[model samples]
Target: MIVGIDLGTTNSAIGIWRDGTAQLVPNALGDLLTPSAVAIDDGGAVIVGMTARERQSTHPTSTVTAFKRWMGTRQTVTLAGKTFTAEDLSAIVLSSLKADAEAFLGEPVTSAVITVPAYFNDRQRKATRRAGELAGLTVERLINEPTAAALAYGIQDRSEKEPFLVFDLGGGTFDVSIVEIFDGVIEVRASAGDNRLGGEDFNDTIIEVARPRIDPEGRLAEVDPLVLHELLRAAAERCRRTLSEQEEASFTITSGDRQFATTVTAGEFEAQAAPLLAKLRDPVLRSLRDSDIRVETLSEVILVGGATRMPIVRKTITRMFGRFPNAAVHPDHAVALGAAVQGGLKSRDADLEEIRLTDVCPFTLGVDNSAPDGRGGFRHGLFSPIIERNTPIPASRVSYYSTLSDNQRNVEFGIYQGEAREVQGNVKLGSIKVPVPPAPAGHVHVECRFSYDTSGLLEVDISVPASGLVRNLVLMDDDEAPNAKEVEARRKVLAALKRHPREDSHNMAVLARAARCYESFIGERRDMVGKWTAQFEAALDGQDPRVIDSARAQFEDALNQLEGDRYL
Candidate 1:
């Protein structure tokens, strides 16, 4: 059976196509959401999901979460005398989910339709695909999480026939997508996001607000830095949840025999959160502008993510669109639910015969070129765009160039991806060098073609058109690319860490559902309710799965309890 997986930063989920319907699979804990954390024991054994999250409060150094933020980089994490690339860590998470699905279905599963942020670039997308492979599953398709959420909502509300906006704010990333439902097909007109932004920023806001109260005299210098950091982070998270319901929340920090307490107000929390909220304004506006769709044309603005639960975020969005956003689908599970719908379509289990989704590139791509000097000389290394922003995916474009000097046998091209006009201002994706039969300067023709697949991964093909010779191009710095041996070694490590068959089933489904709900209600709560959430989360980290499970149930109950009152 093929499943749909949302490999999110802070949390991850999996779903399956079953009996003409899409159902999210619960993790071993019987919860619908699993924290995307991986913990390593001293013996080299690995733990994922709830277990890993539970260990975070006590064993912060041993657990690696939020590694999704470094997916395309060369950074590696060391644990238990073994080195793991970002892809390897991600594989462990994916493998665990795969094992859960296979056990639940009582059969072996091989293929899946994974979801990614619509804004993930070529390297990030490719890294995700590789992670899936390393986890022992063939990725049949990679759909954008926002688009998946929209599809899930579209299927759930089939009666609605208007275009809507999907504002997804997850634990670690922010994505805004505008989708149009014409007849039956779901086409994503435009998508944009700040992958670096999310609920984490809100936690940071809480920290900044509490900083002054902890060290009024700046006298706590001799304390263990790590301990102090953890306490502050924990306190920040606590205070943030508190601000949801009460006008103010206080955090107490204990360092040895010393204790410090700081109270933070909701207004203070909002003020601290304003910068992040402001950063979101431009992206939302840009998404609309790029799609050429006006706010009046939007049928509804659907908020998705745990961070969106903040009142300030909701107000900002409501004011921008001049409409009350739809809360029909829980924000967290919305993406996974949508993914399940797509899984149903892919597996041909749903009543719908075909489902098509088309997404756009969020940023522009370019290559560096030298500008001519005033004295008839030329300076090299300036960037020139090849594919502009908002271009449709699964598309290709080619640009031609001539040799810069006479009898030059080789031409070098530095490629980059970003919206910036200058190459230095953009991200250097990679580069390519083409060797041609010696020709006079400006005599040799080089054709550079860039193809972006459905998954948003880029492939560059450089050819000397005159001789019809072509060479495969490499991206990023040569020193940065992983060698064959390293890739093989990492692959083997991932294989060894693949999930087994005898895991919990119901819990996986629950975790997925809970995550979806968390994403949905995150934007709606007030200060009074936020404190209870903080205590509940703290209580959840006490190691007992049952306690954590009960805490989640109570948290959901509290959210439902406050649903009717729209204070924001």
Candidate 2:
């Protein structure tokens, strides 16, 4: 069966179309949530999910998280005698989720609808697709995360032609989209985001406050640096969660000989988080402006992503829109659920026959040209837009161009994407040299057309009517982005690797959790937790699943007692 996946930065989830509704698929541990982490233990085995995240605190150098932020870049995360890119790390997560789905469905699944941040450029989108390929799945479509969230909300409401704004803040990406439900169709009018911003930054604010108190001289690097960091992070996460429930919270970093405690009130946390809150508003305004959607005209304001659960983020959005966000669709599961619905739509599921979705290109796409400013002079590098931002797709727009000078034999088609009026401020999506018949200025006219498909990929066609010459090409600007051949080669290489033992994933997760719990304590209790954690690790190396399961349950109970209600 086809499914939908939200390959989130902090966590990943999978859903499938069942009957007339989307059903979430649990992992091997029968848990709905899985941490987006990958770790290689000393045994040289690759492990993913909760176990990997827990192990990260103890094995900081061997584990990697938040690699989704590095997509479309040349960044490499090195582990286990191998240097891997963002795609490789993400493939591990996606593959683990695929295994979860397969285990639940009792079938071999080969295709999926994956979600991406709405504002991702072509390169980032392609990287997500490549990661899916490496995981042995054909990514049929890439749905915008916010749009998918909106779809999840829309499916429940029977209203028609209602406009709403979706403000999505995930673990590592932010997206603000203005959308409208026309009859039964869902159309995204505009989208804006900072690909590098997300809810994780909010957690970082807490860490910044605690670090100075714990490491005044910053000499921890010379002595047990990883443990110190683990303690600090564990405290920060607990502190953040506490503030969510009450006005004040105390975070303690106690490990071995180091002990430090700090108390922060919600007001103090909000004060420190002000800068991030401000960063959240710019995209919301930009999205409304692009879509010409006034705040009052919005029938609803939808909040998506686990970050939106933060009081400060919700308050910031309310202050800007002058309305509270709709929490009908849960922030964490909405995108994945919508992706499943989209999967159903893609497969032409009978229940979704009446539902349709259309999304716009988030940015303005155009070519560089010298255009006259109403005055006599011309402005160079002027970005002439063919398909303006917020125009619903699959769309095609054509702009006419003339020869720059007499006997001009070539037309440089410098394609670009962005909202800036100056081409230098925008991203250039490669260019092409389309041959044109040499003629006097303005005599050799050429028509350039850009077509943005449903998947948001752009293809350009340049034609000279007089010479009967036509050329078309898909744009590629970054040299690092792999082509089809390179993707296939990488996929083959990735498929050859040994799959991680899935049945042991639960043990791994609890061990990581134990490590995290161990970071927050000291003395005899710490020793006991450490001993149990080690026992489970040793048990994992044994053959009997029952032995490992028994040890895992006992260790988890020990950790729970040590952790109590404060599960840092």
Candidate 3:
């Protein structure tokens, strides 16, 4: 059976749909929730979950937690002298969850549907997939955390059409999603969030207030930064949690030869967290505006994620909506439970067959263009959106463009993802280049189509009618691109290609690189590169190695002159 896993920042959980219900699986410690921590014991064995979490207080240097915040970056953590990427630690936690699921179900589990923050970008989503692969699980899907919570709440089971909002405040990220349920469909109307703001930020706020008293002489600076941070964070977490239900709490930590203590009232704690609480408003307002739903129209504002348990957070939601928030699902368990529902749907279980889920693209997808600068030149980096954010998925959108100069032989389209008005502020996902018949400016038109799947994979298809050339590419992360052997294996699994000489592989790779470079240039430089490409192709047609090599050298020189030391 396909299990559902919630690989969260503070905790991870596994569950499955069984007997018409989503049942959470217990870990070796007989707990449904497992702390998202990893450490190495003295024996050099990797430990995950509760045991590792407890060790954070004593073995702070050897334990790591909250790596989820760095999921898509180049950040690495060292545990017991071994450096591990955020993905590596996540894979360790996922592996542990997989074992727990297998033990609970009494069978091997090979596939899973994992949940991530709704605001996670392409890189983060891809990293989550890699983590699952490393754990030997086929990641069937990556559902947005808020969307999963809505599924767990069974909004799709209701007979009437109802609109609601999910306010998710997790350990290291916050997300807000507007949802609608109608006719067996659970549709997310919009999603917006601050991936860097969450419960940990609140913990940090507490740390800021308690640090001065805990280390009056700043002696802790002599200790390892990681150790000091973990100690303070652990203490701050306790204070934050205690203040959630009580009026006051003690923030205390022990250093080498001294112990420090400070008492913080709830009001004071709330005052310090005001800034972080303020950050939560924008995402909620953005989601509401995107969905075009007013506060009065929302059927409910459902709260999920562990941080939402904070009384201060609940009060903020109440004041925002002028009504109490819904607490139908357990704050910590909702995401994993909803993930199990998705797993059931993926498996086509009898109970969930009629419940369909549709999610929106949280960010805009488009291309960069150039327009007249009104100074006898052209301005570049203009963003033209094809598929706007909040559009329902699986989605397909098309936009048209034309050659900018007379007899332009090739046109390049840079694919980007973001809400930015300029390409410089957006992320360049990839680019597509298609050859066009030489013609006057704006004479040869090209069509660019983007198709995004539910799994978040994107395929770009470019068609040049004037030249009858079509190019299709599946965009992938720069670091996650397949190697030669993996490419060959994938090619074998898909439709077979027509047989070609071995040299074609080398030629194709070069041409592909050249096409990418073509997208990076504009005006006269673009024209020059296009001409060099044509000449290189002519040399290859001669089938003479000497001629091809000479032309290749010239081609390389021309590219280097324009794009020095820049990889295409």
Highest TM-score, which number? 2
Sort order, TM-score high to low: 2, 3, 1
List residue ranges in candidate 3 displaced over 4 A: 155-157, 479-568
Q: In terms of TM-score, how similar is model 2 to the real structure? A: 0.93
Candidate 1, position 444, lDDT: 87
Give a tens-digit lDDT track for model 2, residues 467-504. Answer: 99999987533556777888788878766666567876
User: Best by lDDT, which number?
Assistant: 2
| Global lDDT of model 3 | 0.82
Candidate 3 TM-score, true structure as reference: 0.84
Residue 480 deviation, candidate 2, in Å? 3.3
Per-model TM values vs. the true structure: 0.82, 0.93, 0.84
Pick by TM-score: 1 or 3, better one: 3
Candidate 3's residue-wise lDDT over 54-89, tens digit each? 567667777789999988778988867777778778
Given candidate 2, what's the lDDT at residue 409?
82
C-alpha RMSD of candidate 1: 7.2
